[model samples]
Target chain A: MRRIKCTVQYDGTWYAGYQVQPNSKTIQGEIEKVLEKIHGKPIRISASGRTDAGVHAIGQVFHFDTDTKFPVEKWLPIFNSQLPNDIVVNHVEEVAGSFHSRFGSIEKEYQYKVYRGPHKSPFLIHHAYHVPHSLSVQKMEEASRYLLGTHDFTSFCSAKTEVEDKVRTIFTISMEEEENMLTFSLVGNGFLYNMVRIIIGVLIEVGQGKRAPIEVKEILEAKDRRAGGKTAPAQGLYLYRVKYSNDN
Target chain B: MRRIKCTVQYDGTWYAGYQVQPNSKTIQGEIEKVLEKIHGKPIRISASGRTDAGVHAIGQVFHFDTDTKFPVEKWLPIFNSQLPNDIVVNHVEEVAGSFHSRFGSIEKEYQYKVYRGPHKSPFLIHHAYHVPHSLSVQKMEEASRYLLGTHDFTSFCSAKTEVEDKVRTIFTISMEEEENMLTFSLVGNGFLYNMVRIIIGVLIEVGQGKRAPIEVKEILEAKDRRAGGKTAPAQGLYLYRVKYSNDN
Candidate 1:
């Protein structure tokens, strides 16, 4: 048996999420169904993490073990042909048996898009979160600086998070605006559930002058979920990339 | 009565077409429904032209006569609020009563997008036509030169077209490649039913080396629908702009 790691890209608009759930369409359910057809048996796969519904992914990594005789090179085309259009298998490779998709990761990058056009664009309906009001990107950048570095991100994560250790190291947080679209890129060793969205919600409030840029520091010190602002909508979030130490 | 002209943009993936049919969801049907709701009576709109099913538009112009007291400045926000997310009323203006959206137009520009990515992109599934095969844009440009003048375009239109006059002047044809997307822009005095799509089909054939660049001359001289190649898919085509003489 050989363990295989594959990179996937998907538009999560129609998916219930990445995980398999009965009576609902999911990215994992569709992928495993295709894998079962290929291997003639049930096959389980492990993903880097779960994304909520309406969140997109450009490079989400997953690993699965299979004992089939199919050549590794042909896996890309074979999986793409059978899977739906929304999910694409970008690259495939053989990995060590002990390499875990979730645990062996070094860093992950995520992006959130916000459309600031006065009128909502039909082309961006499912791809971006529309904010008609004007925003100060400079103020947003100032607020984002306070979110960089290692800290307990309990205030920025969902209240339902079960993990006792809320500490995570955020290496970088950058913001760019082009053509009425604001994109926020965050790289970190790990992120708590809904952490990025909650951070974005607070930064947007800062940009709008509703909250001071210095308020971010106080929110992080509070270390409570109630200190954070509302969570941003799911559509604008994208799982941009996942990095592993082996560089595969 | 005031004649209100509006520039509309839409993603045509969910609509049957631009025309009003008995039992179909169309761009015109939706606009008319909103107009009726605002006016408390039936209202008909005249558009620059009709777009086939799955065809998109960026600057489709339409005009309707209304006796309502709503200020002209308020029409943009009012119409946008009532329309669905897939359709946006970009701009609204008060035009001369005699200025017809269809007849007063001096020029129209259309764009066709071809995605050259090896794997289908879920984000562009409804926005562009995916052509995985390698295409020579230089060869396509060579072929398009033969079509850049006033000529009898009977061979480049749909066989089901009802118009008797097939003569039209193509002012320009430009091709641009950025990233993995190739966009073809055409400016003409007018286009017959599916004329732009048929021309794109022939040009794509030239790009693929299936036909010589000079064959376009023969096809145009034939004046027969069977002489031209297939019609390109509607999704890649967009009515990018419509120009009028008065410039309202």
Candidate 2:
């Protein structure tokens, strides 16, 4: 048996989410179905984390143990051929048996895209959140600094999540704007459920002058979900990249 | 009555085509349905041209006559609110009664997007043509020059088209590449049915080294549909812009 790691990309528009659930189609379900067809048996895989419905991913990582003796290079073409149009297997490699995609990872990066035009673009409707008002990127950057570093992100997490440990370390937050498109990139050791979206929602309010940039410190101290701004829509979020500690 | 002109954008994946048909959903059909709802009667509109199924448009122009005396600036928001998510009315203006969207147009620009990578991208599946081979953009650029200037482009048109006049002037053909994505932009006085796609098919053959750059002259001189390469897929094509000679 060998442990294999795969880089996955998907358009999450039609998926229920990343995890398998009864009576719902999911990214994990789709990947497992393809693996089951190839191995002639059930195979379970572990991903870096779960993404909600309507959230896309560019470099989602997953690992699984397989007994099949097929050459490692054939995995990408084989899986991509069986996958649906909205999902693709980009790269695959045999890794150390103990390399866990979730627990062994050092950092994860996510991006949230926003279109700030008064009229929403037809092509961007599925990929970006539309904000008709002009956003102040400078103000948003100021607010984002308050979110950097280690903290208990309970105020930014979803109450629906049962995980009790809300502490996470954020290393960097960057915002770049071109034309009417604004993109926010957040890098951290890990993210709580809905933490990135909630952080963006608060920054947007600050950019719009509805909330002061300095108020984010007070919100983090509150440790309540209601203390932060509304969660941004899932369609605007993406799992950008994942980093492992043993990388070259 | 006011002669209203509008710029349109649409993702053509869900529609049959741009023209109206008896039992098919189309860009024209959707727009007319929304206009009929607003006017409480039937209204006909004329577009610059019809785009085939799975073809997208970023700056499609159309003109229609309306008697409601509604403000021109309100037309875009009103039409967009009534249209589907895949279609949008980008801009609206009141044009001269004699100005026609098709007849008054002096130029049109179309773009063809190609993704050159071994693995298909999920996000670009609906928007670009996936070619797994490494393409030579320099060869394609050299071959494109043969297509410039006025010519009888009968060989580069669809056999199914009933239009007898196939002479059209290509003002420019430009090739731009970024990473593994290649875009071909062609500006012409107008296009025959399937002209842009057919030209791309020939250029792709040149890029792949299946045909020499100089062979394009012989193909154009043949004036037969079989002389040129196969028509490229419709999903890779986009009507990028339209131009009119009259004063703004």
Candidate 3:
């Protein structure tokens, strides 16, 4: 059996997160159904991570083992033809059987988009978080600097996160502003549930002058979920890319 | 009585069209419903023009006569609050009683977007026309020049158009490419029904090497609907702006 790795992109606007549940529509559920149809049997695929509803992804990765003799080149077109319009299989390749989509990951990058337009744009209603109030990007950048490097991100993750270890190494945090849209990019070894969204919430408050830039340090020291501000809406978040060792 | 002119924007993904129709959801129908709620009586609005289903608009103009003593400044916020999230009221101003939204328009600008990505992007499904095939933007520009200036656009309009006088003046056509998206902008005194979309269809054919650039002149000279290739999809088209004399 060959383990095939695939990179995917999805809108996530209509999905009930990525995992399969009883009756809710999900990205993984749709993909597995398509695979089952092609393989003539039930097939389970593992993803790098799960994203909440209304979140988008540009380079989410997954893998499934299959014994079908279907040509590898034909997989892209056939899968795309059968998959829903909102989910696209971008790249597919044969990988070693030992490669795990989830545990084998080395790093991940995420982006959050904020529309700073004075009025909400119809085109961006679903794709971006609209903040009509003015913000200081410079101040937000200052606050983001405090988040770079290894730290216990307990305050930056959801209270519901079940992981026992809240420690993670953040490699970079960058912010860009273009055409009335503010994008925040974060790269890290791994992320806990809602970690990026909670960090963004705190940074936006800094930008809004509700908190001082240096207050980010105190929030991290607090090491409590209550120290984090409100979580940003899911629509603004995007799983930009997932990086694995050896460029897998 | 004051004739209030308002600039509006809407995402037409869900509406039937811009015109009010029996038992159909429409942009005009939604706006009129909100206005009637404010005026305590049924009110009617006249638009600069009508857009087909799935067509977006960034700067559509409309006018309504009302005797209510509502403050002009409050109209912008009040209308926006009541309108659906897909529609936004950008600006509002009182105009002369003689002003007409449809007849008083002098120029209009329309933009059509074509996505050149090799794969469909989930984010742009409703906003851009995805043409996975490579297109020659230079050739499309060359063909667009032949369509500049005054011409009888009979062949470039929809066959169902009711207007007898198909003559219209096209001032300019400009092409801009940014990232994987190509935008074609057209400015004209007025446009015949489906004229912009039909022109885009023919220009895209030229870009695809299906037709030569000079052939656009012959198509116009044919003065028959069959000469025009196809009507490009409405989703890629946008009513960018409408201009009137004296900026009223």
Candidate 4:
């Protein structure tokens, strides 16, 4: 048996997200069904992240154990032929069996896109959230800085999450604007449920003058679900990358 | 009556294209219906180009005749309230009576995005074409030069086209690549039916060594349907912009 790692890209629009739930049409279920057909055996694939519904991914990583010894080159075309149009297998490589996509991941990066202009766009409706107002970038940046280090992010995480530890390390969070688009990239050792979206929601409030930049600290210390920020919409969230070390 | 020039954006995935047809939904028709409802008058919108099915647009110029003197700023929210989520009315402004979206347009630009790698994706299935081979960019650029300037583009136009003159001027044809995504931007005075698609198809052939760079001129002069390449798939094309000179 050999472990094969794959880098995947998906337009998560019509999907029920990346996880496989019983009797649900999902990204994993779609790929798993196709893989079963190819291997003529049931195969369970493990992924770097289990993205929520309507969230997109450009460089998601996953791994599967296969008994077949097909040439490396044959994996792509054959896998793509069976996958749906909204998802594709971008790369395939042999990896060590000890490598675990989720636990071994050293960092995860996410990006939130905003079309901040008075004009609405049909083209960007699916890819970005349109905010037809003047937002203070300086305020947002100031508020985001408080999230750069390790902290107990209970106030920012989704209240429904089952994780026991609320403390996580955020490596960096930076926001930039170009023409009609504003992008926010967040890098972290790990993220709690709805963390990025909730952070953006609060930052937007700060940018709009409704909240003070220093209030970010108050919210972080509140340790309450409603203390941080509003959750940004799902459409604007993209799982940019999941990084795993080679030695793993 | 006032002639209003509006910049529009739309995801052509859901509609038949930009033109109105019996039993079909189109970007123009959808906007016209919205305007009629807002003003309680008969209105017809004319677009700068009639994009084919699944071809998106970012800055598609359009004009509509209206009797109501409603403020232009009000048009954004009112029309957007009535328009579908896939279509956006970005800007609306008063224009001279002489202006026509199609006839007065001096330049039109289009972009085609193709994803090239060993694997294809499922999520972007409806938006881009998956090509799993490396393309020679140098050859494509070399052949694109042959497309510049005035020429009879009958070979590049679709056989279904009904235009009397096949000659058109191409201002620029350039290629840009980022990682696994490759984009072809073609800016020209005008285009025939399926012209951009055919040009991309021919360029792809040239990039793959299936044809030579100089063969583009031969294809243009042939004025025969069998002389050129196949029409690219509709999903990969985008109507980026259409331009008009002031005081024209």
The candidate that achieves the highest lDDT relative to the unseen native structure: 1
* Candidate 4 lDDT over residue span B145-208, tens digit each: 9889999888888888779899999999988998878999999999999999999999999888
Q: Could you tell which candidate, 3 or 4, scores higher by DockQ?
A: 3
- A118-183, model 3: which lDDT tens digit per residue? 889988888899998989989998998898899999999999988999999999999888989999
Give the best candidate by DockQ.
1
lDDT of 1: 0.94
TM-scores, one per candidate: 0.98, 0.99, 0.99, 0.91
Off by over 4 Å in 2: none
Q: Between prediction 1 and prediction 3, which has the larger DockQ?
A: 1
Order of all candidates by DockQ, from best down to worst?
1, 2, 3, 4
DockQ (Cα-based) for each candidate: 0.89, 0.88, 0.85, 0.66
TM-score of chain B of each: 0.98, 0.98, 0.98, 0.96
- Tell me the tens digit of each residue's lDDT in model 1 across B1-248: 99999999999999999999999999999999999998899999999999999999999999999999888999898889998989999999998899999999999999999999988888888889899898999989999999999999999999998999999999999999999999999999999999999999999999999999999999999999999999999989999999998766
Cα-based lDDT at residue B191, candidate 3? 97
Clashing pairs in 1: none
Which segments of candidate 3 are over 4 A away from where they belong? none
Whichever of 2 and 4 has more DockQ, that candidate is 2
Task: Kindly list the interface RMSD, in angstroms, of each predicted candidate in the order they appear.
Answer: 0.7, 0.7, 0.7, 2.2
Chain A TM-scores of all predicted models: 0.98, 0.98, 0.98, 0.96
